[model samples]
Each structure stands twice: as structure tokens, then as C-alpha cells.
Target: MPSPAPSSPLLTAFHDSYHELVRFVARRTGPQSARDLVHDAWIRLAERQRSEGRRPEAPSDERSTPSPQNIAPRAYLYTVADHIAIDHLRRGQRTAQRFDSSGKEDGPAFAASPDVADTHTYRQALAEVENALQQLPARCRDIFLADRIDGASHAELALRHGVSVKTVEREVMRAMDGVEAALHRWRGETAAPRTGRRRALSSLLGLAGLGVSSSALWLGWRQWVPQYQLQLATAKRRLLRQPLPDGSTLTLDADSRAELRYYAARRQVQLLAGSAFFAVARDTERPFTVEASDVQVTVLGTRFEVALEGDAVLVAVDTGRVRVRDGSGGVQTLLAGQMLRLPAGQSAQPQAITAVAPWRDGWLDFQNTPLAEVVERLARYSPHPLRVEADAATLPVLGRVHTTAVSGWLQLLARTLPVSVQPEEAEGGISTLVIRRRS
Candidate 1:
């Protein structure tokens, strides 16, 4: 044979490297595309080598050049082929920049699970709860909400209202109790005709049985029946010791609302909005679960507070261990006093790790908390909009706050800091707070 042309090194090398390059691509791109990608890469390299009119780069060892008897042409061709294939692939990848065509976008998506946490969703939910408040008694609702949503303490509430501490406590408790009962009625529960109340009504009906006015029963449903909507959107409270068939003992905060779904074996409470401190009674037989936004806080014998704030779920373990499961199959175990602030998006890691919760003694503890946050927390109790300018809210503030008189604290806040608090008339109701930079 014509002692193969002296410049045969390139061809030999290409043949040698080809297979290795294909295998490498196969691993990186998976088996399906590996063959095509690698072969394409090899073809492009061959064209480039041909265009340049250069022998494929080859090992510079001539002394050991294989004799014709041991040319091993197949292996040699593959050797050069591998390098050329990989280089071609790299170049093609850079030029093409293949788009991720997996339909699902790269960023966040709305989800019922903890996977998609949207701040807007949480804010909107809170807003919905606010709208539902319209259905509740105004004064009673305000007082009840002032306690939880506002972070008001009994003494502070008493002092602010100029009422004796005892009366303040009584009124707060009464409001909470009434809201609880109101919610029960709303859920369409019938107050069984008590033997006495029934007899009295029966006697009245017997005397005027023929003339029993239709308006009488209409008035009766309004007066005697509880219209608590089971799936109510408003903020409310719940306090109980015994397992309500579903086996959950919840110490619901003031102005917090929840949807109770009692099943044969499972008692599910969807905390649509607001905060609740739950001490789930042990029922080895049934599971006590509370769904707050995207987080499912489940426990059989644990005490924890799950608050739906903005678009985040704030799970704070008060006593015992509680497991908070997020939308993305992420489960976090919270110990006492540990507050986990889980934001939107499926984050295996917590978005914000906070210090000891202050609401243990029914008071909010603050540590290097922002002034704006303080104002926000304070707004819950008062009939005023409290806001923190972006600059001010971000400024680190360290202090302890009572739930009562969050608005009053702002007065003191102005006295202590250079920040100013102003009201926005355009925003209706006291809930809307628009903090602006002071001129």
C-alpha cells in the first residue's frame, strides 16, 4: 500500500478520539442526545480541520510510530476524534445557548403547597380577612383584634381606655368569648332548643299558635340562631381545653379567623388569616392539623403558634416539638421560642431566622427590630394606621412592646427618635398605614 500519505496523523487521531468524545457527551447530556450531539461535534471538527488544511493535532512521538504491522488504525482514528468532538460541542453550546424548554418557568409559581409562597398572596388573604371583619360587630371586633393583631396588653389597654384594669380584662375576655360563640353560631350550629327555652317558646306558641307571626321566626333566627359561617373569612378567636371531636385545642388569638372542617377521623382547621396559639390535645387515634397559608403545621401533642403574615407563614414553637411542613415537601422542626419566617418560593432553608418570640407573656419582644415593623405590629391594636418610612423601618430598633396601645407607643416613638408618624386621609379605615420619608 502507498505507505499511507505522510500527513495521515490527523485522520488517525480523529478516528482514535471519536468514541471517547461520544461517551463523554453521553454522560453529560444523557443517552438520548449523546450520540447525536457527539456525532455532530465530530463532523463539525472534521470540516474545520479540512478547512484549515492542517493534519489533526497528533502525539509528537515518531520514534515509537506504529509499524504497518501494528497500525491499529481504528483506535488511532478514535483518539483524535474525541478531542475534536468535545471542542466542537463546547463551541456549539456557547453559540446556541440552548433554551430551557421545560415549560415551567425558572422563577416562582403560585401553589397551594409551601412550594409557591407569594407575599402578595398572604397580604391579599389578610386583606380578605379585613373585609370579612365588616360582617362582625364593630366595637367587639376592634377590642378583640386589638388583643392579638395589635399586641396589646391588659394593663396598657386599661390605661389607654381609662378603665379599671379589672374591667379592661373582663371586657377583653368577654369580647373574645363572644367572638368565639359568634363563630360557633356562624358555622350553622343549632343551639338545641333547651328544655326550658323550648317550653317557654312552646307556651307562647300555644297561647297564639294560630297567630304565630312569620316575622316572629324571622326575628328568632336573627336573635336565637347563631349565623357563624363555618368557612368565615373574618378574624376571630377560639379557646378550648377538650378535644372538639376533631381533637384540637386551639387558643385562637383575637381577630384571627379560621375555617373548621370536622371529619370522621381528622379535624382540619384552615387558618385562612390571623394568628393562633395551638395546644393540640393528644389523640393517638386522630391527627390534629392546622393549615396556614401554604404551611401545614401538624401535631398531636405540641403547642405552637402559626401566624399568616403577609405572604409568609410564621411558625413559632411555644412548647413541645411541632413539625411545619411547607409546600415543597420541606419539613422543619421548631423548638420552643424559635420563630421560622418562611417566605414565598420553595426554600429548603428558612428565609428569616428570628429571635425568641415576645408573645409568650402575651407581649411582643423586640430585638433590633425595625421601627416600621414595630409600627406595623402596633397598628393591630389601635384604630389608627401606623407606618414606618422605608428608611425608618429598615433602621434597627431594639425594644420590648406590649400588645396594647401600639399607637400610643408611636407617640413615645416620635419623642425618642427623629422619625415622624403621619396619617394618610385617602386610605380609609385605621388599618391602612402609608409611611413616607420625612421632608
Candidate 2:
């Protein structure tokens, strides 16, 4: 270098607390890579500031150099270092998993002799993805990678970054959108091939005019297209367990129906009718969403249930955080042991809950649930239709109803509530339980 750059106030503070920062990182990642993690953290901090169009101001004299506290918050530095350590450890684990006893690389790698044009395009796409990730805000990038690559939970990320779980979810979504946009740009550029000799020449030249083969274009498109599409439904009184392409599991309640569309960028389920519980696979790059009428529930990875009850949509989280947005653009976040109800023409309000989708465990738990709604749910398990009169439809019912014993539960319901059950035989000899207010 012509001359070493003068130390800025921030750099000076970093130097002053270098040992402490390394010690902090060591506790999380062990002493092996602690110093390197701290160094990387400083580089990340400096790069972030540069990207924001701010250069650190250097003190004129040694005496004027501000104290470490005045220059930069030590806590921020520690946070950056902690994130770096997490990434480093995660990468190390992956590396270990990739190599065999003979040290032969077993992870994904380029073919020993791949097609030149296709390889070039692939490398370009990879570079674009990396560039897009780098352009993201430091916190956003770290949070996304930690959740996706390191498998860190949103709550853990929030605690580490000193932010709410909602903030963490937003940052992850932002990062994913950024990376997806970059991939789309790369695909758009490479998907179209030039004509005839020009295309061949461009491939040979390996210049800015590079052209990919039609086969390569098809392969690229395949990566972006839907990987799996399925329509799942349960017969009356039957429960269905389905495994998704991405390793998630779906349990459909009796008479439930759902459509699953899995793409490279997203895993979506349209809850067309009844209720379904999703044990989502974690892929922060591809968020999982459940669309239920006017309400949409989104999560990076979690176990939750979505149900369509008449004009109302119900969402409950058994684990992880879930974000629910209504047709009116109102958003509510539900944590573990929390539930939300969105009625037609009304806003969603999240409430604390003791159980999430108790129906999954062979019982339907109702807390002051309407009689009509309860009857409709029970009808799914009953061989005969269950109906309630208008006067008793709005009556509030409480307690658990075992799915296997709907008849017994109905008997108890008729006993407790001011309602009588009348068994009506239809023209086809099909019996129906008709409940009416007691005379």
C-alpha cells in the first residue's frame, strides 16, 4: 500500500475491545475460530457502513480519539461476532458432513468436465445470488442465513439480535425476496437463446454475448417451476396423513380438502375446506403459506393448523411463529400456544390457547363454540347429517367432543343444553339428527 489508512474512531474502538470480542465469540464457537470470527465481524461492519454511503470519521489527534463507548456500541460488535461464529460453525459442520473417510468431497460440485456454456451460465447465476445476498442489510442477511443454513429458530434469532420475532420474520422474508428476485433476473437473462451461428459463436467466445443451449434453458426453467402439485382430500369420517415433497407432513382432518403447490421459491397450500395440520419443513429460502379464504398464514418452518369454519378462518400455532394476514391487509403474529380467528368482514385477533388443533389428537375441543359450527364439524365424522335449528344455532357450546364418539357427545349435548335431538329419516332411509330448542 502507498500508506496505511488512518484508523477511524470505529476501528480504534474495535482494536481496543478486540480481545474481549474474541473471547465472546470463543464461548459460542470454541477457541479454534474465535479470532477469525471477530476479524470477519469487523470487516462486515465496515462493509455495511460503506454500503450505506457513510465513511468512518478519523480523529485528528491521539488525544481526540473518542473512548470505545463513544465511538461504537460494544454490544453491536459482539452481536456481529456471534453471528459470524454461528455461520462458521454451521459451515464447518456441513464440510464435515460432505467429506468421507478418504477425504473425497461428497457434496454438490460441478461435473469433472461439464459443458462449457452451461457451466458458465451456472457460475454466473451463482455469482448473482451471492451478490444479491451481499447487498442485503447485514442484520437481514445474517438472520436469513442463520435461519436457513444454520437452522436457528426465529425466537433464537430475535433474542440474539435484540429484536422481536416479528422483526426476525420480516427480515427473513426480505432476504428471501431479494434472493428470489436475483434468481429471476438471472433466469430471464439466460432463458432466451440467440439464433444460429451467432449463438454458437457467442458460446465459443465465452464473452458478454454468451448464449446457453436449449437444453440448458430447459434445465434452468425446471429449477424455477413447480416441483410438486397435489390435491389432497379426506373421505367422510376418515383422517389422512400426507407427506410433502419437501419432507413436510400434512394431517387432514375428516372431510378436509387442500391443494398443495410446491415451487422452487415457495410451498403453498390452499385450504379449500375443513381443517389441516401442517408440520412444515424448514426452508427459509422458500416460505410455506396456507391460504384459507380471506386469511393467509405464513411461516418459515413450524407446526400449525388452519381451518375453514363457515365464513371464518382459524389458525393456531403449536410451535414456531406464524404470521396471519387478512383480506383487509391487517397482520397478526401468533407464537407457540396462540391462536387467531378471522371472521367474515371482521379483523383478526390473536388469543392465547391451551391446545392447537386438538382434533389431530382424536378430540375436537370447543370453548364457547357455536352449536351450528360444532354440529357441522361433527357431521364430518357422523354417518348421518347433523343439523341445528336457527334458534339453537347461535347457542354457545363448550368442552371436548371425541371424534370417535360423536353420537355419545351429541347425546350429552342434548342432555345439557335446552335442545332436543330428533332422528328424522329421509326418503332414501338416511337418518339425520335435527336439534331444536326445547318446547
Candidate 3:
């Protein structure tokens, strides 16, 4: 029988950290190219060693090796692997810039060339993304990495975690938002390129003299129009204020998201999820409309808040009138100091309110609102989900609840209402507060 050839010292080092290196690269370049990058790393390591005149030192007896430390430092291997992965990315970017044999530039290429990739700005963005992932909660990080890096579907994650598909979706959304928020914070001072905006505006103005107005230009732009999405993650505990193209301001609550689209006929805002307060600009010619959950609210100019609560849409007007039309052909008008709740399969009914959109002022006023409903609202600002069980869920809650300290309010519920709050005992460290009736 012939004895198999022993692997080289470099190969041994790579084999030891193979899985870890693949995961690390996967986090950056995604899973599809992770293995290729890993192979590139090994080749780069050998080339680097050869250039430095530091060839792999082979031991006489491989079996006599003391430990992994004696073979090669894992840190050195990982460092070399990272450098190789980065260089691979840079090369890819450079390739993207050059025209192929067809004499056409790869217009869809977003990869940075070696020169651009070597810049500190490029490295900083990469670091920011990694740091953002690190900052996510354990469960959230697991779900995100599993779904993104491991290519697990939402159903798989839900089944693995024993939760619903909606929960998995929310976790993924949270992970993405966390990364975006971290990058935004790190690059807050960085100014956006004004050339594109200037060009867009110039194009619009150039057409205005041709009897076509800015709105008409926007209508045409809608064909290839770009849309911007804003996401507020759980890690971002502050409200986000965004200025729309038409000068309107949008204030989003924590853990909220929305998409903005501008056109000549209308300025549309889609509440993809979560709560938002819109201070719409007056444009009678192009009415502002907010579409959320099966309902659409239109207004020329108004200050109002729209919250997607379960299967219902809560529309509260602070200043101007809001016309809400449901999917079932039901329409109603809400004036200032009035609110309406349009539940699924129900018409919009106006209700009187002393103050509209109180949450904007850091106060949540609910007159005889169910404890379950209040808990649900508070869950948005809370880091964890809130669960009210037994009779406690039906208790009517009145007065105002402050948004700053939801924990204190929950304790108050225990004191005032016949309920007790406690953390649930679960296999995974799921952050959930359970409120049950006091025995």
C-alpha cells in the first residue's frame, strides 16, 4: 500500500480556519463568491510568503507537532486571508471599469477598482457594515446572518425559531436598518453629491419654458424615477425627520419605514410599515397621499399621523382635513382635532379627540383604550415585544402614557391594574415581557 502525501504547512493552516474564513468573506462578498474568495486568499498567502522570502517551514514529523500554535498562528492566517479577500474585491472593481472585448463598458458595475478600493473611505464603509452587524442583538444577528449569508428562507428561519414568517421578516428588516443607521451615523457629516440633483432640477426647468411645468417633468421622470426608502431600526431610538422633494417634512417613529415617490400628478408616500407623521406641503395641483395597509389618505396640505395598528389603520389629523378611503369603497373626512380607526372590513368612523397625534409630543393618550392595544403601541418603542395575557389584556387603560419609560408604565400597570409583569422563561433569550392577571 502506498502512503498518501502529507499536506503542506500552508495547506494545514488553511484547512484549520477554512470554515471561519469562508464565513468572514461571506459576510462581506456574500455567500455566492465566498468559496472563491477563500481559494484566492490561500493563493495570495503563498505568493506573499514567497515574495517575502518566508517559505512555509515544514516539520520533520507532522505527528510530533505540539499544538496549532506550533504549526502557525491562526491570527496571521486570518490577517493574510482578509488582505487577500480585499485585494480580490479591488481587482474585481478594476475589471468592472474596463471595457470588455465587445467594446462596451459594464454599465451596471458597482465594484470599486483597486485604486478606489484601497482608499480609506471604501475600507471605512466595509468596516461600518461589519460593525453594524455586530451591534445587532443575538437573535437578530443570527437570523440575519442565517438568511443572508447562509441563504435561508424566511420560512426556514421562522420554523427554526418557532415563530411566524412575519417575525422573521421583521428581524431581517431590523438587521438591514441597523446596518444602514450605523453607516449613516458614521458618515453623518458626509455631504451627498449635488451634481445629480442639480442636473435633475435643470432638466425640469429646461422643459418649463416649453410650456411643460415641473409637474409635467416629474411625470415623465416617473418612468425612470428613483425612490428613496427610510428605515428606523430598534437600535435607533430617536425619531427620524426627512424632507420630501416638495418641501414637506416626514417624522417617523422608532422602528418605522416608509417609501417616498414623487410625480407630476401626485406626491405619493407609502407607509411600507410602522407609524409616521406627515407635514404635507400645500400642492393642490399635486395632492399628497399616503397609502398604508388597504387604505389611502389624501390631502392637499395637512399635519397628520398614520399608524398601521394590526389590521387597522389609525389616521389622526392635527391641522387640516384628511380624506381617508378604505379598500371596501368606504370614504370619510376627518377634521382637525379628530381621528378615525378603519379596521379591516369596517368603515372609517370619526371620533372626537382633545389632542391629535399626541405621540408626536411624547405622550400617548388613550381614553378607555384596551390594555392590549396600549401594549401593542408601546411595543414599537420598546426594545422587546410586549405580551398581555389572561384578563389583563382586556383591562381598559385611560389617561396618557409617556413614551420615554415604558417599563415604568408597565410597573404602574401592575400597581394600578390587577396585572403582574414578568419576563417569560423561554429556550432562546427572547426579549418578551408578559403581563398576566394577578392571581
Candidate 4:
């Protein structure tokens, strides 16, 4: 080893270290990039070795400063290789940027050497396995790709998708289990005697009918009953024309809403929120009723409006007789052209009125009803609030106020009333209908 030059210890150490570094880089970057990264480091090392006025081979004592104590050849080569690999990545990145901007690549920047190409073939093999995984069930395919391709842990993936970590683990295991089971079955079929194998194949062919029958049954079941079911229900103000499954008609007024539910035991619909008009379909077995707050407006067969205004629940029957009942079993019957107002709270006494139902012909009919009360009803469907002074509140109105058209009502109110009904402007999107006496 005297004056070590050709086939020297330091030269062998450097070459071996470079090869190891290439293998490490190959795991992350493709093998072509790995060789480029490793070769660049070696090129720098060779240039340095050649510069030091040394022979055509490695120098014996002419080594770079050792990285650690006792300064070994392996440690020095590893240090040099790491720095050169990083620099090669930076330079390659700049070359890629320049090529992208200019739309030209003069030569291959990361071409694989023969040995590096062999390592890169592993990548192609993994890619083929990836394509095979796509044929698996959706959940199984997702778990396999996340674990193998993206290298995500089961726990990490489970938390990301709001599933249990055990679910993720089980999915991956299931895919591997499938492969093992398939391989075992294939081997069993192959090693069997010809007669036995033929019999097994015939048995499998016969079972194909069962698979077809099961598929047909599955289609039939989907047509009949579903395994998973979901439905959304909410109560909000709606039009009166919505037909009930019980063959009843609903004539709900504006700002009046009801939830219509047809359950198995009984057709139970709780007007859980707003008010509504009901035209009950006669079911002597299951009498239709409108329950609001505490009072239930029971009817034999009728067209009626069940209005909720502050503490008073007003029931105006337009057709058949309605039996107004308190939740405590007290009932009062009111006939058509008759309105009943029941006070909310504990006292369930009902007041029967001779007034007509306002919305019978899409007009607001008032038999000496307060002017302010009529104005209040007008404000509900309007895109504005109606406001009147206290002095104008007690003025009695006997005419019918048609509310079907917004413009028609506006014009009618302006012409008939002593109070001038002029529209007013309000802040943001709010509008106000000003009802003041004419000057």
C-alpha cells in the first residue's frame, strides 16, 4: 500500500460511498435522478483528486479533512456526497425552469445510467400494481393507494376522512387477504387430479345461477324496500293548493304554514310553527282537526282558517261546522259565517263572533272591524310594513278589502279611506306604507 495510487483504499471507499448514496436517493426520487445526484458528487470528488497534483489513481494520505474523530474515508465521502447531491438538485431545478420558459430542452437533464435504469424499473412495477388496485372495491382501493402509493398511515387517513383507524387498517388487510385467498384457491385448483378439478369447475359453473338469482333479488328488493332511508321535513308558510294524501284540501293563507305528515298508525300533522287554513276531508274514523298552541279546531267537514295572532287563536269557519276544543277536553261548536277567538294561556274560553271569514273570496272582508287591524293584515304579504297613527286605529271599516293583487289593494286603500295610504321609503331594503289622514 506504499504511496497508494491505483486501486487504492481511499479510491475504493469513495466509489462505494457514492453507490450507497445513489441507492438511498433511488427510494424517493426515481433512479434516473438518483444517478444524476450521485454522479455529480463523484465528479466533484474526481476533480478534487485530479487537482491535488496526485497520480492518475487515489491518493494515500491526500484525503479531505475527516468528518468525525479518527476521520475515516467512509465519513468523508458521505459528507462530500450529501453536499454535491443538494447542489445538483438546485442546478437541475434552475435548468427545468429555464427550459419551461423557453419551451426547449437541448438534452436529457436526468438520464438514467444502465444500473440506475434497472432500479427505476421497480417504479414501473409498482405502477402496474396500482392499476390492478383500481379494479378493487372503492373503499379497498382508496385504503391501498393511501397506504402504498402515498405512504399514509392508517390512523392519519382515518382521522382525515372521519372514519375509525381500525376501519382503514381492516381495509388494507382485506385487500391483502383477498390476494392470499385467491392465490391459495388457484394453487388448490391447479394441484388437484384432473377428474376432481373437472368436478370442482362444474360445481362453480352451477353456482353462477345462484349469483344471477341473487342479483335479480337485489334489484327486486331495491324496487320494493331500501336498506338505508333518509327524509327531511320542515314547517314553513306555503300556498293553499298543496293536496294532502288523506284526500283533504288545504287553503292556507299567506304567512300561514303547516307540516303535513301521513304516518302509519294515524295521519298526524302538528302545525308545529305557523298558522294555516284547513279544508278537512271527512274521515269519521279519523276526524281531521287543526291543533294550534292549546286549542284544537275539530271539524266534521269544513273550510276554515286557524289564525294565530299574539295571545288570541282565531278560528273562522267558512263551510262546515267546527268543534273548537281546549286541550283539557272542553269543546265548543261554531257554524259557518261564524268566527271564534280563543285566548292563549291557561283560560280556554272561546268567543264566537258573527263576522265573515275575510279570505273566503281572496278579499279581506271586515264587518265593522278596526282600520288598524285591517292595515296589520295587509302588511303580512306586502314587502313593506303598514304604519298608522293612534288616532286612526279605532276607525270602523265595513267594506271588503281585496288582497289578491298588491297593486289593486294599494289603489283601493288610497281611494276609500279617510286616511291617506301613501307609500314611504325606509332604510336598507325596508319599505313602509304610511297611512295618515289627508291634509
What C-alpha lDDT do the candidate models reach, one value each?
Answer: 0.51, 0.70, 0.65, 0.53
**Model 3: worst 10 consecutive residues (lDDT sum):** 195-204
- Tens-digit lDDT string for candidate 3 (1-439): 0011123455455656677878987787666566545644554444444444554332223223233335455665665556655654564555555423455564554532234422344345445656777678878877866654444656678788998766775687577566545555565644243221111221223221222222222233333232223444323346777887678999887667887776546778889766899999899898888999889999999999998877788898999898999868788888998988888767866887777666678877878878888888888767667898857877998867778888778877776788888888665878678999987
Query: Cα miss at 379, model 2 (Å)?
Result: 0.8
Per-candidate TM-scores read 0.42, 0.52, 0.48, 0.40
Model 2 Cα lDDT, one tens digit per residue, 215-322: 232244335434467999999889999988788999999998999987657888999999999999899999999999988899999999999998999999999999
By TM-score rank, best first, the candidates go 2, 3, 1, 4
> Cα miss at 2, model 1 (Å)?
99
Query: lDDT of candidate 2?
Result: 0.70
**lDDT, residue 86, candidate 4:** 52
Prediction 3 global C-alpha lDDT: 0.65
Candidate 1 lDDT by residue in tens digits, 1-439: 0011235554444334545655765665444444444433333334444555754333233223333224565554444444444543453343333332345455332212112333332333333333445455654455545543343644566566776655654554455344333333443454343221011211222212222221222233233222222454333122222334434555555456777664334556788766667777777665667888778887767777787766677787767777778877788876766667776545454333344334534566666766665555555555655556676667666776666646666666665566666666653444545555455
Per-model root-mean-square deviation over C-alphas: 33.0, 20.1, 22.4, 28.8
lDDT per residue as tens, model 4, 96-148: 54444344565444322224543343233333333444457877766754553
Query: Lowest lDDT 10-mer window, candidate 2?
Result: 194-203
Which is the leading candidate under lDDT?
A: 2
Best prediction by TM-score: 2
